[model samples]
Target: MTTSPILVTGGTGTLGGHVVPLLRSCGHDVRILTRHPSTDGVDHVAGDLLTGEGVEAAVAGAATVLHLAGGPKRDDEATRTLVRAASRAGVRHLVYISVVGADRVPLAWMRTKLESERAVAESGIPWTALRAAQFHDLALTMVEKMAKLPVFPVPGGLRLQPVDSREVAARLAELTLGAPSGLVPDLVGPHLYDLAALARPYLRHSGRRRPMLPVRIPGKAGRAYRVGANLSPVGAGAEVGKRTWEEFLAERLG
Candidate 1:
């Protein structure tokens, strides 16, 4: 079925950089809604989700709205803005990319994502929210920052399932092209490892050998990580992603 022009938020972001191309490659007419006017070549409309600027024009006549923009500070308002605009424009489906265990994770950032999920559900637009594990690049970035110190310090017993952003983008593209299924199964990495273990490959690849020390993190956030609240233990929709953390690190750091 041919889709109406698809409007994508965060088109230049980590996930959007992949999702937009996949959509276009599949022959969907993709347009980006961004603060800046430029989309690096793809058609784009300037908009700001926080202030509701240029959003209605962006959402106008869109069959599906793939919402991938948001930060801790702006996620709630941004999602609300997009939902209202999409509902008004009669968008058929809205696809959102969110983090896994957002509701359970004790962080302000996670709370914002959870709030955004709720807003999307209540928006009255046919919508699907896909929760994904940490992107491998982000995990590697954390390691990159920690390696700068003489010794690498990480929260004790914290675990992560780092999925590839490209894989996550592929799943989002599949959902955006299909019907809206609320709160779909999570997309997680093939392997689960502790923070230190996750960082080891990066450490070895960069030839930076420092003692990876585990330090106890205080408060509820730390406890959440220690308990693996962020993990998708049962493979809700696992085995779909074949890229391993080591492979991602090799490509990134090596």
Candidate 2:
């Protein structure tokens, strides 16, 4: 007997790109909804979550829904739209991907994720929200962007335990297959490092030399970052991933 497909929003995106195949490899049919359907191996549905176009159709008859569409813009509103569509379609489980310290961090993106989490919880659907640390892919991208500059500017007192995107994807897949259990513990990186230390390896790998300048981002947000709102606490019910930042850069830059 075949099971219903797992519907994934942002299926073409970073974490979703890793997750789609893993879910398929587990013997489940995966349906990915995107505004513009691509020629990927999975079933692509043309849909837009923000405008509620094709959302119901995309979610229809799916056993599970993985909502991983994250950005500074349209995240919270898209989540709300998805929750409503999932509820209407009677989806068995709705899994949300969120930032680790979304609730505590003063950053706009984190706040948006926090709001999205609340939408899922209040949707009255069987739902699970799994918050994860910064993806190493993102970290690499940030470092790559900074490498272009003559001098690398590091955020003062900001430390991140950047976990691999694939690890986060694996965790999301597990939750998507299992029962919805509200909020799960954060999936964090194995170790933590400050910005300068994190940037050094990237520079070395790319054969770039620059002075690491520590810059304070003035305001309440900066203060929150300095206080470690983004870093998972010790024994905070964290699921530590194996891939370190160094390993990530070595693999990519080697």
Candidate 3:
């Protein structure tokens, strides 16, 4: 079977790590855009998205561009640089992995994501933006961080549909293979839980019992989560992940 070369930015990340292998298994040639050029089965293109360094050669002749370069922290300039470079390189399709509630969230990080989505939309390239809910791993990380605090302050009454990172990666790879369909349905988990309630299991597993104080985060972002912006009840088809919060905690804690 003929294989098309697909360029994956942020190829070393958690989601990217899973995506790279999945694409290769499907008989697609994977070119990973990374700062360090490492020949680990897949082709590694050395580049930095912040300065638009080496992006031209990285994306050259690629059939699809999985734009997964943004950091959890905000950097508008860097994101804009990436969008411009991809557009200039004439990429066939751009698949952007964005976060859920980014559009309604007031947090700086979420706002930056929203802006990146906008840039992709206006770039004139065939693009598909997959907005996903909070990763199950991210929730675990939050629990660890909160454990260090004297009192864990979490968003009260906020319904979160935390999906597995692996599932999100699989969906992204499938989307990259096909044509861009601008703003695909948000991918959510099978169950919704309050932030504090979700952390309780992790806390018990870790043998650290701390006071869980739920607080209402006052802002548009907070409102979005409360109203289920992080969930995709109905739209595009969503794959239900089998791993639950308890399963995730047991594996991580053990």
Q: Which candidate number would show the highest TM-score if scored against the true structure? A: 2
Model 2, CA-based lDDT: 0.89
- Go through the candidates in order and give each one's C-alpha lDDT: 0.88, 0.89, 0.81
TM agreement with the true structure for every prediction: 0.95, 0.97, 0.89
**Winner of 1 and 2 under TM-score:** 2
- The residue-by-residue lDDT of candidate 3 on 1-254, one tens digit each, is 24668899888888998998998888888889989888677789899887778888887888688987777675456667766777787877988998877776568888889888898888888899998888888988877887899998887657777888888999998998888899987887778788777878988887888887878878776777677765665655765666677777787789
Model 1 per-residue lDDT tens digits across residues 22-102: 999998899899898673678899989999999999999898999998775869889998998899899989999889888
Candidate 3: deviation at residue 11, Å?
0.7
- Weakest ten-residue segment in model 1 by summed lDDT: 232-241
Evaluated at residue 109, the lDDT of candidate 2 is 78
lDDT of 2 by residue, 1-254 (tens): 23788999988999998998888888999999899898867789998888989999999999789998877786889999999888998988989999988988887778889999999999989999898999999898888898788889999988999999999999999999888989999999998989888899988888889998888989988988899988887778899999999999999999
Largest lDDT belongs to which candidate?
A: 2
Superposed by TM-score, candidate 2 places the C-alpha of residue 174 at a distance from the truth, in angstroms, of: 0.9
